[model samples]
Target: MLKFQEESLRQSVNGALALRHQINPFLDAIFEKGITNICFLGIGGTYASAMQTVSHMKEFTSMEVFAENAAEYITTGNRRIMDGTLLIYSSVTGSTPEIVKAVEKAHAAHATILAFLDNPNPHLRELCELCISYPQNEQLKLFMAADRILFLRHEFDCYDDCYENFDCYLADALISVEQSSDSFAQEFAKKHCNDTLHYFVGAGNQWGSTYSYGMCYWEEMHWMATKTVSSGEFFHGTLEIISRDTPVTLFISEDASRPLSLRVAAFLPKICANYTIIDAADYPLIGIKPQYRGFISHLVTHAVTNRIDVHLEAINCHPMEIRRYYRCLEY
Candidate 1:
């Protein structure tokens, strides 16, 4: 509870859920025009979140869905981005130069562009065909949009029931998860605060969360050195570097790729003494259905890790917001 603001968190979650009304209608209008493919574009953390979204969408639908790093997409154009493509984007500032340039190219290609903005910027709003401003929870909004698309395509029959649960119970469930996971996060942070390097591994839907935490949170925010890899690929080359003293954290989710993380968990104890496992199944989701848990597994992992972030900040006396060269200098 160091920096937890209960009311603010509740309001943010509720605000995201409330956008479902607008999201569905907006998606419906676009679908009526007929889209041949869907593309998600972003940078850094947003790119990581898009990875999870693309992964989740591929599971249930056969639609051509993919994600691209805006920086890379602008450099090496994707052939799939064409006249019938539906491009989705998300940003906190809505002014990232790479994203703006990429959007311009997509627009010229006649792709219908939609953006989710955490902060309002008239320039970005004018560029996007449609823009929705929300408090936070970009991941949830992405999932909602994906689910609505699936429903419209006659692929997701239970979308309404699942979203109803999300509206009624998700906020409280996430709050409970934060409260329950705080102890583990505190202990993990205290033990690893001074570690020189950290290895993060995860698979399936949680891979994006694992990557973002290691890169965006630990490296960018905390100024720590970390390497993130998928659990499925750990044994390929990353496992060779593991030793008893090496710090490693594995994230496990309830998706089909859960077995990949389980395989890593089985091998870690035999060689590495310093290993931590954060499993979504260990936490209770309250009213969320079992079948839909896989879809939101990344969100649960994020909630758990948010506690680790705060604890690490407090233990190291390093504010999470302070930066040396991130936004302060020209890159």
Candidate 2:
């Protein structure tokens, strides 16, 4: 009774859309409580949480806001927190050593600590004044992390125009992707013959799309060295290394992202041994326009890579022998 095509689509889109509803209320609560100069820290997939926070908050306040590797803050000691700084963390498991240590340090320094943890992990509770737990599954944790951004943006109370514009972005991203599972991995791998490196690039609020599994998936699953950079950097400098033997996967979306996608698409033939351009121009998410078709395409790309990992594992081919990567995550 379950169709593979429809089933696959549902899986991907639901995975993408679920986060908004789950995370928004928690973050909106934080924003309403009046925290200024917020910094978020996390590891791995949790990193996306910080990205989502920055994307929404950037519109509301420019007050020295950014997210960085947690370790970066840990080394500086109390100096990391100014009079107004409030630190929040997202660690799905409530554990990732560096993040845990950093949260402890922030609390010791008298910085307010808020944590979005995956469970009622005792370590997380001890280190923060506020510990918020969500469903612990990989997909749902992402939902909570993402929705926090929308809530935070609303709390910051941007000017009417800025708030409206970001809301549109949040709406499109949340509504557009539906759960689906069409594996495009074989199609991606089929293009590689002698083996080659790939670079994924994106900019603006969507730039995090480049590194989402692009670099890590290649190294962990495919045993390839993939590099991800911004479109401008790839054009100005990295383009020199690109040639007929190099492979490039270009993501083109509709939202304020067309020119760069087109530029890369136009230059593909001259610079690569192989090139694939995904047209995210007409994806059927209710909140997104056709230009943002790239989201569904991005899902397909990630699915394909994981599928190929499964095949490689079946054949005993992965160099790292990364058996089901998550199961191998060292914590």
Candidate 3:
């Protein structure tokens, strides 16, 4: 466990569960006033996370949910972002320029804004109608909020049963996944440490994790070149580019799109010997219901990949926190 802190991880997961108490009440209040649609607006990693939520909502709930890149939303506004829309956002700094501007636009449109911030930014706070400062597990909190909304609408009857397990056992289950996946992660780091390019593929709810891991972690943090594609779209143009030596990883989850990833998994072995498959099914959540595993597969994927990130940092001798130009100069 390089750079691992068990207590901190446990606390973060537990704290996210506790935050649900605060979140549910606020959602209840907002629903009373009426909400026509839900819009998830964010930048970079946050935007990808919003995509995961929207994907899940599409499968289980009929709610009009949209995930938009904050910068793009500012350029071409969405007609759905009007009076009764509830705009949801999550940010580490809470002051990204694009996000701030997007929030301003949503505010002017008479949409109610709710933001989850990792750090307090008064300026962003002033723009949001409801802002909660939670330093970790923002994705989990976002999913919880989404589920709570669905529960209130009578769309998710198992919400209470699912969250009861989340509150009591999710942290331990996630930690167990980290422990179980550590050896594979270590080997993965050693094997791919110097690879020039990485191609990641995933489907369903796990697609966001695949996208974020490629762009945010491998590219931004590790300074490695990478490309991500959804499993459903892989054969469109991406499949021909793969050769036997090309490094590819497929993330498989228990959602409806699992078959798409499985299709890729089956094809990769015939053409590419360097392919890796990280299946959420391999790690069983001891206390979580079988029906709810799809909802938290992204979290499980993170727990496994977090180990790989630490190992990669050690092998590459490049600290994960260092960036050459991300925030060092203005564009």
Model 3 worst lDDT run, 10 consecutive residues: 54-63
Query: Which digits, one per residue and each the tens of the lDDT, describe model 3 over residues 101-157?
Result: 999999888898888998878888987788889897867978988998999999999
Query: Which pairs clash in model 3?
Result: none
Off by over 4 Å in 3: none
Ranking by TM-score: 3, 1, 2
Pick the winner on TM-score between candidates 1 and 2. Answer: 1
Specify the poorest-scoring 10-residue window by lDDT in model 1: 120-129
| TM-score for each model | 0.98, 0.69, 0.98
List the lowest-lDDT window of 10 residues for candidate 2: 174-183
lDDT of each: 0.90, 0.55, 0.90
> What TM-score should be assigned to candidate 3?
0.98
RMSD of each: 1.0, 5.7, 0.9
**TM-score for model 1?**
0.98
> In candidate 1, what are the lDDT values of residues 205-314, reduced to their tens digit?
89888898999999999999999999989999999999999999999999988999999999999999999999999988998888878878888989999999999999
